[model samples]
Target: MKQKRRVRVMVAKPGLDGHDRGARIIARAYRDAGFEVVYTGLHQTPEEIVEAAIQEDVDMIGLSSLAGAHKYLFLAVVELLREKAADDIVVCGGGIIPDDDIKRLKESGVKEVFTPGTPLDDIVKWVKHNITPRQD
Candidate 1:
């Protein structure tokens, strides 16, 4: 039997948002689910997060924002990825996001926005179903 290649995911905190307990928890969940997780620590700019995503060569970029700047911050990262010709990278996010904004977020390129209380297993399953890992 062939072993499946592991998926690589980058969990990032963008903008001035300093509350990272949720980010940390999700990162751990992803790690525990057998993904190769790269976490960009707190207080990262959109540039920093995208740059790290490229450098890390991640399959997906997961943004965590709780400071009410999800619109700007999430879109910024998505835009940068497009600008850099890295649009193939999947992007997802989680935090205190409003239900009303979820549609706009998906339309703008975020594949998923997992709000607080979302099951960790659901996220794991989503990634497994959605992304086809890049071959090195």
Candidate 2:
């Protein structure tokens, strides 16, 4: 029997967000939950994040933004993925985002948004239910 490919997720910190404690924790949670995880350290541009996601052939991108640039930075990643025709890679975000912006983010192509205090297990379960590893 052929084994299933593990979900591959890229957790990224976009823009000038200097905070990464949450990103680190979630990366660990995904790893512990049996997903293949790649974490891009702090101070990453949306372009850098998108490029890394594509190169890594990730099934999804979990962008973390603590610095108030989620409106711009997060959308940029989604847009870049579309431009690159890699929109098949699911994009989601979390961290310090205002509830008001969450609606906009979702409408703009982000699959989901997780605010503060969201349980790690919930996030993992969402990934398991929503994402499938690339066959290639």
lDDT of each: 0.92, 0.94
3-98: candidate 2 lDDT, tens digit per residue: 888899999999887999999999999999999999999999989999999999999999998889999999999999999999999999999888
**Candidate 2 structure, TM-score to reference:** 0.96
Residue-wise C-alpha lDDT for candidate 1, range 21-48, written one tens digit per residue: 9999988998898899998899999999
Model 2 clashing-pair count: 0
Off by over 4 Å in 2: none
For residue 77, give model 2's deviation from the true position in Å. 0.3
User: TM-score, each model?
Assistant: 0.94, 0.96
